[model samples]
Target: MTESAEVECVVVGAGAVGLAVARALARAGREVVVLERAGAIGTGISARNSEVIHGGIYYPGGSLKARLCVEGRRMLYTYLDRHGLPHRRCGKLIVANDAAQEAELTRLAERGRANGVEGLTFLTSAEARALEPALRCTSALSSPETGILDAHGFMLSLQGEIEDAGGAIALGSPLIRAEASGRGFALHVGGAAPMRLNARVLVNSAGLSAPAVAARTEGLAPEHVPQAHYAKGNYFSLTGAAPFSRLIYPIPEAAGLGVHLTLDLGGQARFGPDVEWIDPLSTDEIDYAVDARRGDGFYAAIRSYWPALPDGALQPAYAGVRPKLGGPAAASDFVISGPEAHGLAGLVNLFGIESPGLTASLAIADEVAARLSEAA
Candidate 1:
């Protein structure tokens, strides 16, 4: 498609969120196109971190991540099942090591219940320990809804739906700029055959690049754009299975959950995501190599919950960046700027869609579609 031509929708950034928007649009009978800066989809946050499906337990009640995560967690399992996507509802345990931490676990269960999380229950330390003999805790909350999935494969499934529905995803087509055209907008896409595309609606799901894309989109105000921060978190893998059968997590930190335990399809375990504020952001730097020395703190925390954890067992696995809405000392809810928020026509900007983003992709897409449909 060229600048002179027009489609129903043009989705920028082909990560999980972008692909989900494309899939939803195609399913809704719209001719959509996805422009990706990477050679393939899910190269950004989608590929790097743990594939844990969040159970919407952490956010404040009625928050976007909380609501969508709860709804999305349920929707995701269905999508995975219907499409034969690889996943397992391995469940999860939020452990509290002592009296003080036990209060935190109670707070989490209450928040989960207030956020409409189903099947959440409190367990005594002994109950928790029995479930995973290696686990030691003063108390715990069991979330049966959480699990992991093949994230890349999930994106592929969304891409397949977009293609099968007569939509196209222009790989390597980085969004250079966009201009306001007639009632729609014109997009300058960067790629092998650099070209332009016109669309009636635009959805910026550009993950890390979201702020820049919104600033570049036609008829958008730069001041309205919030500064994007790259909050980097590192992960460490266990050479063998984690003694715990379910995913285990510490209470959430300011920007993310504390170093938590997550498993893969193979049931191998990894823990991590220590937060660090980044200055000059560069997502391409794939420092998958992690430092084993950091395990000292992890050992301290894990030992608080599982004291018998053998020393020198946790190895550095990988790390990923979170596109955050807040910096230190702040915890901001996600920003999903639609036409009303920005006063633009037929556009939606997804900002601060970090942690639970993978779990909330489908529901978030449906929301973006509903918002855009009203504007369109």
Candidate 2:
């Protein structure tokens, strides 16, 4: 029998949340170890998506999504500034194309206000277009806090912090399964040499495979975990030139931001993230290839607000899958289940972390740290 490797905490998955957990635990003087399935950290959904740091504007007040997003949004900008990370506090404008949509926009503002997000302003169409001369809108709400950052740079900064705090991140060390042994847990890792990780705490921030990982651990009840659904958003980038200075969006639908337009730190414009439900098929079977025909619907949606947009300029860019917990068009909350929820010990499973996950990552880490501390 192989001997066990001891650690204070073992965080499976080195995505944004996982790395954040490790960094927090290590910063708190806990001996932390991170195991990543990919050859590198942040290679999964962390590296994917629009890299937008969302302002807390969407969820109900007092919800985890609302509280964590607002807190994390503020902390992220500070983190970026501290690390010299590439970012832009480029704001976003949620548009109301017509009178009917204006009510939804108002509701969103109320939602944001309820969540304690300040400076969310309702603007008339003229006021909205004055800021973005190319923009044509009936009404708009400006979220000054919304922004974008170089995701890779941000993640690299996080890795540096984790390592500097005397924590270790092992890439390609996938957690095969886990079983409880005494007060700690034993984890089986997929590698040439089988690893026996004995840790006081286990963090399941495995993103897409979170539920599956939780199911793998011994003594964890299956009914306690929900099935993980893959929500894929396909992006179609605009060809050359800029359309607007800020990120533009229609009212958010349940699954995603709709076919909204989001720009990078650069002034280039790209539209996308049309929501599609991914079935439980092989990863290879679920294609990330963009469908050019999909842009026909996109053109209609964008031109509703920007009427001057020329046709045939839209092009296929990239597609990303969001690990979702709910069905299409269903506004959902972030699920960070701890021992209290499942009556388990030393386990934290993060499920249905979509959208503002990039914004709420730091606050998520704080929640995890508090839970682990309580467990201890």
Candidate 3:
């Protein structure tokens, strides 16, 4: 016999995005319950990331990524400050290795400005070198708003807020299946203790498993379920002291942001996330191991901007897989589908929420809440 319960809202996956969504709904006076497949919160995509607070520079103007990232960055900074959480607006520099790449930097600066990103400055080679003498570039773009934070701390803060608002998170509980029941959703959850939840609202923010979760929904059409692609990113940590104080990035790549260097709150620098697409049957089948040989490619990429990078300086740090909607050559934007998209009154599915997902979490939550409220 399965235990049964009822809730006003159910948020699948207790990642940063899911927790933020739950927090928003809970604060809105809804009885929300978050379900996590893993034994812990944020053990999936949220655990493995650059943890960099993006400056909304790479995305196209008028896109959700641009608007939410810019909006969320401001909100995040304020939230962190108020909560006394650890973070730093240490800033970042997007370096153009040669004259050819300088053109790309100019385009990016324009896009950033159009997206309402603040404090974007173009720097000549001399001006850039003056700030970071170790960097080698023909030109660079300074995004003073770019920063890093304690991602885990932020997620925990969200969890605390949800609890404070009388919401709960059920770890180790996965949404086995979902069916549209009248205007609400009938959710069958599986875990150490299997149970059923009749939720007035359902949000599929399952990260990598988002497509899989949607596939299991009875009323959702197959056309609405996009193919899930896993792009594994491997990081290599610096063996010695970091030469630069700020985050250093080469121009963006098609699959990812390239082998950019990001600093942790402790000021330790790590470079990574070189795109390696894998065909995994499920998220459980994917391996998170960082292949040491991949570090071979990191040398040339890092050397382009920091020629002083020494041999054997990089060690296998970790690996993270982005839940991508497209392949290696194609790019995709964040898809937050609601009732308007699929005619599902109380369901919202999030797809391809990579990169700035962490930075845009709170804003994403706000959007999800508004969509559900309108449907209600």
Candidate 4:
């Protein structure tokens, strides 16, 4: 027989989004318990990626990605300021490599406007070169609100808020199974000390594993769970001093935002995240290795926008896999499934939370809280 405990809410996964959700509920006076399979928090999808604070561009108008990113970016800056977290509004430039690509820049600016992003400025190649002397482009769109932050520090702050409000984050604890209980959920937990938890709510913010978790849960209708796909991106760190003062991006690609230059808080420049679709039945089959041979492709892509890129300057740094709902041919939007969508009361599932996920975390948390409240 499994030991049992009770809580107002049980959140699976301790990624950035999970922590944000936990903090939001705890602040609302709910007794929340966050379960993480890893020994430490943020070891999964949250730990990887570009860590760019998006400026509400690059998403369809009125979509959750656009709305939540715009709202979340503002909330994140405010939260970081109030807490003195490590972040910088260093800005970003979306460049079109040649005159043939100039129309895409115009469309991006128009899209940004539709998405309510502020301060989007169009620039000629010469004008863009003025901002970042080494930048090469036919035209560029400057997004002053786009930036970078210390992702780890941000997660720590969310964890701090959750704990301060009496919420517990149980690392090394995984949700083995979950089923709908009377007006809530019954969760079977796995860890050093296995037990069952009865809670008023269940939130699956498991990031990459969310789809799998939802498929296993007893009450969730299988048809409600979306198919899972992975798009792995590889990053290569620049070997020398940074070439540009701000983040630099080429025109977007079908599978991702494209191979771009992102600067860390310490000002080190790394270019990469070229899209490579991964096909694996289990998460264990996914490999995060940054293949050096892939650097040949990076050199070519990076040189297209920055001709000054020297040969052999690209070094394999890292790789991150984006949890996607669809494949390269068909992109998917952020899926936030509440009781309204699945008819499962007190349960919310988040899927395809990649890219702007770090930027949209707070707003996502707010949306999750609102959904749960409506069910209440």
The TM-score values for the models, in the order shown, are 0.96, 0.97, 0.99, 0.98
- Scored by lDDT, model 2 comes in at 0.85
Ranking by lDDT: 3, 4, 2, 1
Best of the two (2, 3) by TM-score: 3
Candidate 3 overall lDDT versus native: 0.93
**lDDT tens digits by residue: candidate 2, 1-376:** 6556889899998888888888999999999999987888898788778999999998888889999999999999999998789999889999987777899999999999998887899999889978998888889999999999988887788888999999999887888899875586888887655678888889999887787788888888888778777887878877788778899989877677678888887777888788778796644366778888888888888887778878788888888888777767456688988888976688888988877888889889999999879977
Which pairs clash in the backbone of model 1? none
Clashing pairs in 3: none
lDDT of 1 by residue, 1-376 (tens): 5444568799988999889989999999999999899888899888887999989899998789899999898999999999999999999999887777888888989999999988999988789888988877788899999999999999999989899999998888898898865577888877777777778888889998898888887678787799877887888888766687799887776777888888889888888788877755455553555566777788886676667778788887777888887887778777889878877788888998898999999999999999888876
Predicted candidate 4: what Cα RMSD to the true structure? 0.9
Poorest lDDT segment (10 consecutive residues) of candidate 1 = 280-289
Tell me the tens digit of each residue's lDDT in model 4 across 119-179: 9998888999999999888889999999899999999999999999999999989888998
lDDT of each: 0.85, 0.85, 0.93, 0.91
Candidate 2 Cα outliers beyond 4 Å, as residue runs: 1-3, 282-285
Candidate 3 TM-score over all chains jointly: 0.99
Worst 10 residues of 3 by lDDT: 97-106
Residue 354 local lDDT, model 4? 90
Candidate closer to the true structure by TM-score (higher is better), 1 or 2:
2
lDDT (tens digit, per residue) of candidate 3 on 182-222? 85999999999999999989999999999999999999999
Better of 1 and 4 by TM-score: 4
